[model samples]
Target: MAEEQLVTFGLGTEEFGVDIMLVQEIIRIPPITRVPKAPDYVEGVINLRGNVIPVVSLRTRFGMERVEESDLSRIIVLQVQNKVFGIRVDAVTEVLRLDTESIEPPPPVALGMDSHFIRGVGKIGERLLILLNLDNIMGGEINHESA
Candidate 1:
């Protein structure tokens, strides 16, 4: 059976995962430079060793209530379609491997804010992971918004 590796993290009480291949690195929350006229979800840009990368708040993107950043907060740097950006998450839990068979299609009721960004739901023992579609999450709309 084929297994897929994921970089799992927390957003509030829920767990989310993305393809490990798409993740460049994970870093603690950094100072972000707010952009003028950027979307609310666009937290701003960050300088990572001279590379200025845009950062988005997943909480805002999902229309969730905002909370104060804590020590567990993280910025997950991801590269999708040649574009690199960071997503602010509550915390990063772990990198896990799940069998492809354990993933199931998302139910219609699961559709919520930016539901299209969800690839599927993975069932691993007692845990449920919301698999993300990185491409869709970092779609062109975000590029246009940040530009």
Candidate 2:
């Protein structure tokens, strides 16, 4: 049997996963040039090898209280909507595989927020894997009124 591809990461205690193929690379949070009218969740933009890439703070995007970026914080650069953006995470765990049979839908209440961001949940050993939907992760929740 072949193992499934799962890129694991975390925020405080909650763990998340994304398809490894979509992930470009992981780097420590770097200086971001703030955009004047960008959405609040859009942290700003960073220059990667001279190519400007927009960045998003998962903390801000998730409706959670923003925490200080510590030593372990990382920017998981992903290619979404034909654009490259870095999604901040506490720390990246490891890439593993879980069969489709192991994935499940999120429960009714994920703290009152929409559960659409979660792609699927995979029970791995003792921890539940919160697979993230990169497509809808930073796309749908954007507030134009506040921008």
Candidate 3:
């Protein structure tokens, strides 16, 4: 059976994962420079090895309550459609490979989150992983025009 690798992370009490291939790197939360007119979810930009990469708060983007940064907080650098950006997440859990057949379509009720953002639900033993569609999550919001 075919298997796919995933980079899993936590947001509040929930766990989320994205395609490992799209992840550029993972770093500890870094200092951010706020952009005057950026959207609420946009936490501004950070200089990564001289490149100004925009950063977004996943909590705010998902309409969740913002919490103070903790030791576990991390910034997941991702490349979507050739655009590089970082997303602040509570904590990165682990990298795991799941069988493709174990993934099912998103359920009919997605707890009010836009179903389009969810790529699939992966079953790993007794654990259920919410696989996010990175394209849909960052594509519409992080295009150059919006930056």
Candidate 4:
């Protein structure tokens, strides 16, 4: 089987990536219809064409500093198993292919932060990106009260 490239986006200065197969589309941040009693990590649901899809802020989920929404903000729709969710990224970057040998084990700090969510780390040029296990990252409950 051919190895697939990973698609990544920026959250602040940090870059986060996921398997290309999981991403359905990337769009500009839109007005999200807030869902009552939903988790804080979930920005809320948006009408993607006619379907209602939940949007999540990866920054909030990973305990990163907040960012103001701008043109750069983008929604990366992903299919985590059967459920499809939209991830709010600071910005979407280019797609890059890395041979399997280029991926390394995630560091202890990244692993400790819900270790299961991090699949591995990939070095592209001089920059390093953490590849996320979307299934694990989106599996937990999100606290809406904090949102």
lDDT of 4: 0.82
lDDT value, residue 131 of candidate 1: 95
Give me the runs in candidate 2 sitting further than 4 Å from their true place: 1-3, 140-147
Over 19-135, each residue of candidate 3 has an lDDT whose tens digit, in order, gives 999999999988899999888888999999999999989888778999999999999999987889999999999999999999999998874577877889999888888998876
**TM-scores, all models, native as reference:** 0.93, 0.88, 0.92, 0.89
Residue 9 local lDDT, model 1: 96
Model 1, range 1-147, lDDT digits (tens) per residue? Answer: 999999999999899999999999999988899999988889999999999999989999888999999999999999876789999999999999999999998877675756687889999999899998876665565343434
Query: Candidate 3: TM-score?
Result: 0.92
Ranking by lDDT: 1, 3, 2, 4
Runs with alpha carbons beyond 4 Å of true place in candidate 1: 139-147
Angstrom error of the Cα, residue 16, model 2: value is 0.5
| Candidate 2 lDDT tens digits, 45-90 | 9999998988898888888889988898999999865668899998
Clashes of each: 0, 1, 0, 2
When sorted by TM-score, best at the front, the candidate numbers are: 1, 3, 4, 2
Residue 40, model 3, lDDT: 88
lDDT of all predictions: 0.89, 0.84, 0.89, 0.82
**lDDT comparing candidate 2 with the true structure:** 0.84
Expressed as tens digits, the lDDT of each residue in 48-73 for candidate 4 is 98999998888888878787898888
